[model samples]
Target: MVKDQLTQIYTQNELSCMATYSIKAVYHKLMGEQSAVTWDKIVWNRLSIPKHRFILWLAMQSKLQTTAKLAQYGISQSDMCLICADAKEDHKHLFFACSYSKECLKQFKEWTSITSASTDLQQLIRNIQNGRRSKFQKQILLVGLAALVYLVWNSRNSSYWQQSIPSVNYVVKHLKAHTKARIWAVLPKKLSTKDYQWFNEL
Candidate 1:
């Protein structure tokens, strides 16, 4: 119906329809789309997953990478991590397991006053969503998490393409810049204490 027609249009030009159909699909639910929370935008942009496929993939992967399965993509099964050459390339390593990422999370926890379990991606998202915080706080956390994921993935690509290593601070800095631009453009006001602190340090 309207959703299908809008989806077709969205596929053709995301920016042109940003104000009309996309925003409406998000905040207004003109079609059979889900309600837009900050998490919705965070997840959509960060993962690059289609809206319809996100939940299904979450159910399957729980946010952790199954090395055995993903190995078909040319990444070694034993190569558990692409960032920290020392760690296994799994969800924890990518997000919380690596030294740099661990440090970043430490700052994040201190700033946000939120704690996350050493779980897979799906669990982490759930933890952030169920957090006892304001909608604004929740959106910030989602943005951070999304930024972290996207940064790690890009770092992996860098490692492979350039045959070089990336520092923890480097990835953190990149994520901060990217997230800052996107969040500032779409949302009102400056970042919170935690996000601002991280951005400043970056």
Candidate 2:
């Protein structure tokens, strides 16, 4: 099938003469194009840690292997949440719906002054993307949210493997310190003075 497609392309392009062999043109012709997703910016933000971005990518697609997913495959014995133990351990419950994750998000919001009232992960990301904050502030919020998601998932894994979860305080503290340090390390050269001051104040 691939050979037939290549033969068609060659014949259509009339490669009998001196034809320029552009790999990019051939690749694009073969692969075609795909529409961009709304969360692309949130997941691929330059300010976010690479590992955090990877986890957020999986999470935005609901691809994380939570207990509920494991249970679907007869891998886990129960679908109960490992962190909260009061709900099914799916992507939604493990994000901000769980008590442990809720406190972490609340503290993060209080620290960052994020006013969005949404608890759903995707909705919160959309709020940040469309909020009336400065570009730098939006980037910070998105990166911080990604870090929170990564840490929350990490805490859930800790509970599953070690039978203990990190405290909410611990998670929030780690989130603040790690995210702040990460942004500080990669501060953009074009950052406005006001945004720099605001970041320093945070």
Q: lDDT at 92 for candidate 1?
A: 51
**TM-score for each candidate, following the candidate numbering:** 0.55, 0.83
Clashes of each: 5, 0
lDDT score, candidate 2, position 6: 73
Give all candidate RMSDs, comma-separated: 11.4, 4.1
| Cα-lDDT of candidate 1 | 0.58
Q: Can you give the lDDT of residue 118 in candidate 1?
A: 49
Which candidate has the top score in lDDT?
A: 2
- Mind giving the per-residue lDDT tens digits that candidate 1 earns over 80-191? 5665668656555565667766766666555546677544556677787787766666666666666666555566667767977677677667656665666556664655
lDDT of 1 at 103: 69
lDDT value, residue 76 of candidate 1: 62
